[model samples]
Target: MSDHVMACIDGSGHAMAVCDYAAWISQRLDAPLTFLHVLDNHPPPDEGNLSGNIGLGSREHLLEELAMLDERRAKLAQEQGRVMLEAARERAIGDGIAEPHVRQRNGELVETLSELESETRLLVLGKRGESAHLASEHLGSNLERVARALHRPILMVPETFSAPERVAIAFDGSKTMRKAIETLAASPLFERIACHVVMVGADVADLRSQSDWAVDTLNNAGFEAHGAVRNGDVETTLHDYCREHAIDLLVMGAYGHSRIRRLLVGSTTTAMLRSADIPLLLLR
Candidate 1:
């Protein structure tokens, strides 16, 4: 597997937080860091729409001018992406990375990331993107798509970042959660951080056993691990736990539930991404 951390950059409020968090992860894992800015190639709404009829000569002239406009727009977007990538690189260096790589591509963000997934160890991006309203509860349009398409772990940062001191994992003893636990044990990303394994459901003996096993696995791996079972809705309970414990980061499996179930009810992953103030590390 590759060992580089890739931070997605854009002209959003969360860009700086993405850089800082990426740098923090790179330093922790002693991995290379990269800053990526992708210029979306989708044309503007008015690109080829011509209103009203006109003479052939006039129509041809208008078409030429519209082509020129499109070219200019593409060029401007490319330049803007370059500037964003450069700024992200500088921020990463300032955050203690000696050297960070930068790349700008012209394509959809999710497709671009999928093509470069092989070279990525961890993917970091904002929960929201440049086009998203800062005050809106909606997540970045591409956040869930990227998570669903990629197999690598993704660290979704908020609009602000702080070095994580307390980490919580919403464990449910599923295969996905078990994989998350194994990854945490094997990876040095959270070394020595206080870890809480939180499970929400009926307080049954089997659930307690699973939580204990998770806590023990993490504890043996040199983490300050603790286990707790809470009773309530999964998303609300997790949020409350994080707030009450002052958790700096939340870790969990991404979209572990089936699509049908999520559609019928809702997805905890989506809910957390939508509302969590702290950063999230989602494992697939």
Candidate 2:
């Protein structure tokens, strides 16, 4: 299986945070590091329709000019991506990575990532992209798409970076979440960090049992771990738990529940991504 850590770099406020977190994870896992940038050069739909409104001779000339302009833009975008990748590479090296790879591709973000998914053990991405200003209330437009398309673990960073000392796992007791706990136990990313396995539901026997199981798994793996059963909404309760515990990072099973359930009761994964200020490590 591939064991490289891939960090997606773009012109966003979260880019620096992404780089730092990726470097941190790479060092912890002792895995190869790669910085990826995708150039989205699809022309606007209206551009093609504009030619019909002009005279034949002028229209042909305008089309030619438009084509040339598109080509220029694509080249510029590639250059910009190259520069960004180079900077990320330097940052990774400064963070103790011996060697970092840089890759630039031209295509849609999700598609490109899906194509390279097999080579990625972990993916680090920003919470927002270049269009952050346009949608401050929402997560990065491509985040959900990419998360759904790839089956690997993903670390989504906010606009700032801080090495985590305390990490909380939002447990739900499903097989999906249980698998996530096992995966976390096998990884070094959260080694030696304080871990809290928090479940939001009635303080029932089953809930406590599941929580204990998760804590035991982590403890066996050498983590400073504990478990808690809270009563409230999943997202709100998890956020409150993190804040109250001064948690630095949140771990969760991304979209672990069924789509029908998510539709009936909004997705906790999406809600957390939209509201949580701390970085999230999503296991799939």
Assess each prediction's global lDDT (C-alpha) against the native: 0.87, 0.85
Angstrom error at residue 88, model 2:
0.5
Q: What is residue 98's positional error in candidate 1, in angstroms?
A: 1.2
Reference-based TM-score of each model: 0.92, 0.92
At residue 127, what lDDT does model 1 achieve?
88
Q: Tens-digit lDDT track for model 1 on 209-237? A: 99999999999888899999999999899
lDDT for predicted candidate 2 compared with the true structure: 0.85
Rate residue 6 of model 1 by lDDT: 91
lDDT, candidate 2, 75-108, per-residue tens: 7778988999999999989989999999998888
In model 2, what are the clashing residue pairs, if there are any?
none
Error of 1 at 280 (Å): 1.1
